[model samples]
Target: MSENSINSARRAALGKFGLGLATIAATGTGNLASAETTPTSPHPVVLDRFDHIVLTVADVERTCEFYVRAIGVKVETFGSGRKALVFGRQKFNLHQLGREIVPHAHRPTPGSVDLCIIASTTVDDVIKHLKAVNVVITEGPVQRTGAMGPIRSVYFRDPDENLIEISNYL
Candidate 1:
């Protein structure tokens, strides 16, 4: 089919949901009813980017060390000797298994996350670093869709089998 014909068909299909293709592209996919149901006044609760995250681990020390070696995160100690793996503005607070600090995830489990982190350097450099640290890459330095758009990524498993993806925006 002609490109114009295909595009028209796609637009018509999207129109069935009461939204045109342009609206969907600009506003993102959300409940269509939200436009009518949402309050006109600003909501009280507002949130932004993550400040830190928690990783419940079998061995906090081991996890910290592995992250330090593989990704160049700084291992830090805070109040009460609690450990955190820090990079850029975010940190991963380590919670030892069966002894997690209070106010944790309802079902916090190790190796449950498939986290994608943006790297400061190139994907090639990240691959080289992972190899030097003896971390086996499970997937790629190939093209993948990142949150912002196209990215090049490398995948590997951390000590607890958590899938770690290092990416560079393309």
Candidate 2:
């Protein structure tokens, strides 16, 4: 395909994901990776798994409470009441909206993240647990493509309405 048509097609695809060309232009990340190609021209960097991710929420304690009940994570208080939801190999630092720590996102908005998490338990068991805790499953026990391969996922919303997909690799 011609470059112009390729770019136009990419823009259309991104638009379907609610990502506008403006978002791409603003970030200057237009020429990112695609499933069809690997952009390995740059030097490959060796890296371990993610240490943690910061979750911006309205109320830290409330978000912590919901994650604890919904996902079985242990909530821990860190420096100066900073909260984190700790799972086996993942930790999410809870940044209470306006009171975010330094060097955070440009606009750390709550409910902006569609986070996909790998669960240790079966998706069916997770659905039952979610129902038991009064958490509404938005969608799934459906199949989806994950980073590693096929995953069975159940979707739900956090306290801040962040879409959470709990999945098990199949």
> In model 2, what are the clashing residue pairs, if there are any?
none
lDDT of model 2 at position 158: 94
In order of listing, the candidates' clash counts read 0, 0
Residue 115 Cα positional deviation in candidate 2, in Å, after optimal superposition: 1.0
True-structure Cα RMSD, model 2: 9.8
Q: How many backbone clashes does candidate 2 have?
A: 0
Candidate 1: give the clashing pairs: none
List, residue by residue over 75-136, the lDDT tens digit for candidate 1: 98998999999986679988888998889999989999899887768999989888987999
lDDT, residue 20, candidate 2: 26
lDDT of 1: 0.76
